[model samples]
Target: MIYLDNAATSFPKPPEVLEAVSAALSAPASPGRSGHAASLAAARSIHRARKNLARLFGLPDNSRLVFTANITWGLNTALEGLGLQPGDHVISSAMEHNAVARPLNRLAAERGLVWETAPADGHGFSSPDDFKKLLRPETRLVVLNHASNVSGSLAPAREIKAAVGEIPMLLDAAQTAGALDLSDAGDWLDMLAFTGHKGLLGPTGTGGLWVRPGLALRPLAVGGTGSASESIRSPDFLPDALEPGTANTHGLAGLAAGVEALLKKGVDQIRAQEMKLTGIFLDGLSQIPGLTVWGPRDTNSRVATVSVTLKGYSSSELSAALEREAGVLTRAGLHCAPLAHRHLGSFQGGGSTRFSLGPYNREEDLNSALSALDRLARLKA
Candidate 1:
């Protein structure tokens, strides 16, 4: 099948990534657990992955990087470990996924911390000006997604940084990590939550959070960190403070290879290819009657993800038809950001059908998808 649901997880990872993971799993010992050769090797692999991530994100200190199961866990580590107390305010955008919104909402409801959502424009893009106007003096943290998972709308990170003026911004890079330029964001962002399976082309359950220096967060879990064995509490350090148990060394090994492949291929080239494919799909979809494409009409302001709805059918129907009848796989429903759907007016009925492109997508795949969509539209009409 032609997979267009890359926003969930990328398929067809590089062969090297698979090899790395298999080799790591075949190794004898776990990383950071023992002083044996196998353990040392595993530790070295993990260290290499950390360094690669730091280099990719333009982080000065590799030690500040901590691995998590995925972007959700990374965001959890950043939000929960920050020790947000009662009465403190947190600001976020209306375009946030459940990963960011659910936890914050729970915190606000239980702890009495004030939660404010910055309004976005009609296209689900938030303005830095509107974000600035909503900031209260008690606002302790600002969490925003780098790009909308539903609409692929890009956020104004620099402008938001300038507006907040050092109020600890945590940028969720789940949708933009390997697809867009993110090295410059590290300088302005206090923490960044990233996933490995999407644009990074790594195996599932691999992700991390890069923390800036001079920021201390409480530990989410306290256990044996291969350090402070004599003490009962977790080690008060950058990685160990957050990474509680044994690390995902196998996943990280594969992640390192994936990251290396991305660097080798060049992000700009990959982005250009994705953009070309998305443009082709967009143009083709626009020609079909009863198809309404969402997000920025111009390709410059969005990622390769596009959401659409048919005039007479639900998104699920279109997605199923594409998958079953046309051999094209696409995602249907809210795409995990229901507020984003509400903003786009897609929540009242069914959510938009999303087609997210990856680096490996080719012109032929675009043509096939477009042809399938055209046939589906004709049938509906």
Candidate 2:
């Protein structure tokens, strides 16, 4: 199958990543557990991985980056650990995934913490100016999506920071972490969440959150940090403060190798190639009749993900037909982003067929998909 479902999880791991994981599993030990050779080796791997992540995102302090099971857990840790009082408000974009929306909604329902969203345009873009109007003194945090998972439109994080001046922001860098350059994120963001499975080219069950200096969050879970074991409460430091139980050192080993390779290859180079491919695909898509391509029409404002709706078919049917007839793999349905779909006018059509590009995709893959879409669009009802 021509794998185009990379937004969910990248397939065919890099050789270095695979090698590192294999090496760890072969001679494994719990990280931060003991002083033996195996334990020390695990600790070394996790430490290196944290440093690599810090370098990737321009983080000054590597220890501030804490690992979680996935981006959801990282987000929850950030949200729940904030210890917000009643009537505290959060400002987020309409393009956010349920990862942010669900937790905030639950907070509203349970804690009386109301939240508001910055609306997006038809192209899936939420302007920083529009975001500015929604800001209030009661706003405890500003949540930003670095890029949309559906239309792939990029958010103006730094611009929003200018509008938000001094208010803490949490960036959801799920789609842009390893796919794009963010060397200056540390300058603006107080905290952010990232997943290794998508753009980072690492294994599932690997992701983390990064907190800037001078920010202290109440520990969501407080027990067994390996350090300060003598004390009843969790340590007042990072990594150990947020992380509980045994670490996923084997996955972290893969993540370290993945980010290292990404660094060597260069983020700009990957982005340039993806934009060229997206241009080619978008040009071809424009020729097809009865098809609506959503998101920014130009490459300047988006990633490689493209969402499309056919005139006479549901997204599920089109995806099923494409897979059966063309051997292409694409994601269909709501993509766990129902509010985003509603904003983009795709919710009524049962979501959309999403074609998310990865570094491994080539020109021929897009051509093949476009040809298949052209043929499929012409079929009789």
Candidate 3:
């Protein structure tokens, strides 16, 4: 089967990731719970994963990195942790996923906060200037999705952060974490939430958030952090303040190995490979009649994900046909980013089919996808 759903979750995880997970489970271990040999080994494994991710994101302080269930948990923590009072303003973009939108909307309804959406062009690219125009005296924070899951269009995150000045910027790097070069994140990003199952090439149940120094987020839940058992209040340290209860030691073990492999191979090399595949796929897509491609036509402005709508076919119908005829798997519908679909004029048609390429995908996979789409388009005609 040709898998093209890397944006949702990567497939065929690295062998090292599988091995690391197995090794962690092979021994009875509970991270930070006991000083026993197995427990210490688990704690060390978690620390190594945190340190590797910190280095990957250019964060000097690995202690500030807190592991969570996924990016949604991190985003919620960042949004709720900010001390936004009534009448405060928050700025997001027209291309954000529900992760950002839902939290902002809830805050608006419950806390009397004002939420504003920065405008984006038809291609779903948000400009820094647009963000600057939305700033208000009460604006407390600026949140943005680094890349649109539906269109695969990238936001000018650094430029937007620079435009907003001191307003804390939260980045949802769900799509770009392991696929893009984020080594300079510390230079511009204030807070970043990432998932491991996607680009990180790690197992599910592994993700993290990195908070900049001096930026403290209120813990969403308080419990035994395994550090401050003497007092009732949770530990005020970096990760201990945020992460509570038993840690996901087994998942972190795999995550560490995944980041290690990424570091060794280099993010730049992986990006180059995906770019080459995207260009070839785009070229093939352009030749198909009745197929309207979405997002930035330039491969440089987007990730490897490509979205398209074929005439006479709903997103679901097209995806079903692809899988049935050619065993090509693709994700259809809004991709949990309704705002993005509305911004790109695809919401009325029930979203578009997304073809997300990964490092493991080959030239022949793209060729198979293109050929299947071409046949489907011809049949519809």
Candidate 4:
């Protein structure tokens, strides 16, 4: 099958990633938990992964980074760990995925914290000006998605940072982590949530959160951190402060390999290739009658993900047809960002079809998708 759902989870990870995981699992002991030779080697591997991630993101201290199960867990750690009190205000955009929205909404309901949503432009992008308008003196935290999962609309983090100076910002980088250049996050963003399975091309269950130094977050879990074992209380520090229990060593080993592969290939080169395919697909889809493409038409302002709706066919029907008849696999429906769909005016009807590209996608995949859409349009007609 021609997989076009890389925005959800990348497929066909590099050969090195598979090898690394296998090698790590074959070893005898766990990392950071023992003093044997095998344990030391495993611990070193984990440290190497941390350092690689630090280099990829241009972070100075690799130890500050904490691993989680996925981006959802990272986001939750950032949100729940902040320990916001009642009546405190939190800001987010309408383009946020359920991962960000669900936690914030829960806090608003149970903790009596205030929540406000900023409006996005026509392209489903949240503007800095709109964010500034929503800012109140009581606003304690600002959560923004680096890219919309549905429309692939990117938010201007630099502009938003300039507007809301010193206000702690939590950036969800699930979509943009490995695809976009974000090395300058240390200067502007307070916290970043990232997933290894998506753009990072790692196996599932690998993700992390990076917080600025001196930011204190309450521990979400407390038990067996391999440090301060004599004490019942969790240690108050970065990494061990949030990461409790045994870590996902196998997944992290694969993630380390995946990240190294990305660094070698270069993010700019990957983005350019994906954009080339998106341009071809968008151009062909636009030529088809009764087709409406969503998000910023400019490829520069968006990732390789594109959402579209055919006039007469439901998104599910179009996706199924593409998979069955054309050998193209694309995602359909709300894409877990119903608020984004509402913003794009696709919620009243069925959600739009999503085609997300990865490094493995080729020019032929775009051509095949376009050709299938062309025929599907004629069939509807």
Candidate 5:
């Protein structure tokens, strides 16, 4: 099958990632569960993965990285842990996925915390200046996306950081973690949540959060952290403070391999290839009559994700037709970002069909997708 849903979960993980997962299951159980040779081996694997990811993001201390089940878990952990009391203000962008929106909405009720979202522009981009205008002195936290999942619109995170001036920033790097260069995050970002299954090219059920130094978060859930066993209370150290219960060592093993492979290939190289594909795809889509491509029409300031709608086909209809007729798999509907869809003016009629690209995608894949879309558009006409 031609997979175009990398924005949701990447397909056909790297061979090294597959081998690592199998190797972990055969070697040992979860790390820190015991000091046995098998367990120590597992712990070492986890450390290696952490170190690789830390180095990728330019983080100094790998220990500050905490693993979670997914980006949603990491986002929730960071959002809820902020300990916002009544009347505290939080700022975010309308392009945020529900992962960021839901937690803040709940906090608005639970702690009387108020939140203001800067609306994205016509191109589905949230400008740094828009956020600057909304920032209040009481704004306790700034939640922003590294890129929009719906349109792949890259956010000006660093520019926003420069404008915020020390207000703690929580970044949702779900779309840009491995797809874009984030080595600069170490200095400006207070925290970042990433999904391993997406751009990281790892299996699902594995993700993480990176918190900068001097920022403390209240633990969401407390239990056995496999450390400080003598005390009944949970340890308030780096990862031990956040990680509870047995870790997903098997998934993490694959994650390490994936990150290692990405580091070797170089994010710049991957991005260049994706940009070439994106430009070709966008140009092809624009030529088709009765079809309107969404988001930034050009390849600049965006990832390889492309969204579009046909005159007669709803997003779901087009996706179903593409999969059934042409074997082109895509994601349709709101993509869990209603505000973003509304901003793009695609919400009223459902949402846009999204074609997300990854390292595995090729020029042939884009050609096939465009040919299929042309046929579909002709049918609609």
Candidate 6:
């Protein structure tokens, strides 16, 4: 089967990732929970994973990295931890996933925050000026989706950060963490949230958040961090303070291996391959009649995700037909980004069929998908 749903989660995780998870399971050790050798080994594994991810993102201090269940958890932690008072404002892009939107909505309802949306253009592209215009004296923080999961529009992170100076920008790098080169992120981004299951090619239940030094955020939940058992109060530190529970050691082992694979392979190489596949798919899509593509049609301005709508066809119908007729897997509907779909004019039509590529996708896969789409397009004609 041709898997084109990398935007949701990646498939065919690296061999090392599978082996790492298996090894962690075989050992049956809980990190920082015991004093035995196995426990020490588990703790070491977790530390290595944190270090590798910090290096991957070019973060100077590895201790600032905190593990979480996923990007949603990280986003929530960052948003809620801000301690925004009444009349404070938070600005985010219009092309945000439910992760950021829902959390911001909750904060607005509970904390009386004035939530603002920075507008993107018709192509889902937003400039620094868009955010600059929305900046208010009461603005406490700026949250940005580094790239749109629906439209695949890459945000100008550096520019936006510069425009909203010292506003504590929180970057949701869900789509670009492992797919793009972010070695310079430490210099620009104040906080970053990432998921390992997508472009990192890791198992589910593995993700993290990183905060810049001197940025104080309240812990979302206070529980046992396997540290400071003597005191009833939670520890006031980097990771241990934020993390509260038995860690996802199994998934983190796989995540560490996945990041190792990317470090060895280099994200630039993976991005180049995905871009080639995207260009080919876009070229093929243009040849088909009655097809309208969304987002940036070019490869340079977007990730490998491509969204499109066909005349006289619902997105659900097209997705089902693709799977039934050609074994081509694709995701349909709003992709949990109703705000994005609404902004891009795809909400009323039940969203659009999304075709997202990964490093594992081949030229033949794109060819087969294009051929299948051409045939499906002719069905209504």
The TM-score between candidate 2 and the true structure equals 0.98
Positional deviation of residue 270's Cα in model 1 after best superposition, in angstroms: 1.2
On the 0 to 100 scale, the lDDT of residue 154 in model 1 is 85
* Local accuracy of candidate 4 as per-residue lDDT tens digits, 292-320: 98888788889989999998899999999
Per-residue lDDT of 56-140 in model 3, one digit per residue for the tens? Answer: 9998888988999989999999999987899999999888999889989999999999999998889988789999999989999
Pairs with steric clashes in candidate 5: none
Q: What Cα-based lDDT does every candidate model obtain? A: 0.88, 0.88, 0.92, 0.88, 0.89, 0.92
Model 1 C-alpha lDDT versus the unseen true structure: 0.88
For 1-64, candidate 5 gives per-residue lDDT tens digits of 8999999999879999999999999984769988799999998888888988898888988899
Runs in model 4 lying further than 4 Å from the true structure = none
- TM-score between candidate 6 and the true structure: 0.99
For model 6 the local lDDT of residue 367 reads 96
RMSD to true structure for each model, in Å: 1.1, 1.1, 0.9, 1.1, 1.0, 0.8
Predicted structure 1, TM vs. truth:
0.98
Off by over 4 Å in 5: none
275-381 per-residue lDDT for model 6 (tens digits): 98899999999999899898888788999999999987899899999999999999999999999999999999899999999889999999999999999999887
Model 5 vs truth, CA RMSD: 1.0
Measured with C-alpha atoms, the lDDT of residue 32 in candidate 6 is 98
Please estimate how well model 6 matches the true structure, expressed as its whole-model Cα lDDT.
0.92
lDDT of 2 by residue, 53-103 (tens): 889998888999999989988998888889877899889988989999899
Which residue pairs in candidate 1 have backbone atoms (N, alpha carbon, C) closer than 3 angstroms, thus clashing? none
| Candidate 6: regions farther than 4 A off | none
**Model 5 TM:** 0.98
Q: Worst ten-residue run, lDDT, model 4?
A: 181-190
